[model samples]
Target: GEEAARAAGAGDLNVLIGYDLRFWRELSALVGNPYLSDFFHRLRVQSWMCAVPHLRRAGDLRGRLWSGHCDLVEALAHRDGRAAHAIIAEYNADSLGLIERLAGERSG
Candidate 1:
């Protein structure tokens, strides 16, 4: 899907690839740098926490189910590190809600 979409688009694709946690670490180092700050400002992010940590740390057993999706969506949605984190947070919360309804309770 990514290649197909890129082919259809005219602009050169700029792919940012890195482990979500690693990416967050890099962003953490950029806070004092003006260029990085400017980039985040462009992405409309107010805080570093929004994008970094896009992949929520899995909780017990149930949290494992939501981690990948939360990371992927957040990673793709925002250029800034903090937005990813926020999206992941939202995604994980929503996923937990769904699981609660479907599985009732995960005791084991």
Candidate 2:
């Protein structure tokens, strides 16, 4: 999370978010189930794709996800599974909402 904050502070949003993807990929690797690991990898890629179009047009909002990442990292670092899950769920919901809003604006 500190790495991400540094990247963001350096004005490289791509690197900032890419750190998140890398973190998830590393985490997914820890899953003993190969199938679930593969699923998480795919989902991470999809999430990255979902952000691409908006990244160019709405980079300002990228900071919104940053704090969530910090909270998520703290939860995971403390081994608080429940808190981590809740934080991740909230992050996903926010991401989905942002994507939907961007899609609507593009279509309408």
Whole-model Cα lDDT of every candidate shown, in order: 0.41, 0.71
Worst window of 10 by summed lDDT in candidate 2: 58-67
Q: Candidate 1 on 1-108: residue-level lDDT in tens?
A: 233223213222122122323344444445677676556554533332442233222222322322343344446556656766776687569646745544543343
- Model 2, span 22-106: residue lDDT tens: 7777777777777888898888788778677676676565454444657777888899999999987886787677677777877
Candidates in order, TM-scores: namely: 0.27, 0.71
Off by over 4 Å in 1: 1-78, 105-108
Clashing pairs in 2: none
Measured by TM-score, the strongest candidate is: 2
Query: What RMSD, rounded to one decimal, does every model reach?
Result: 12.4, 2.9
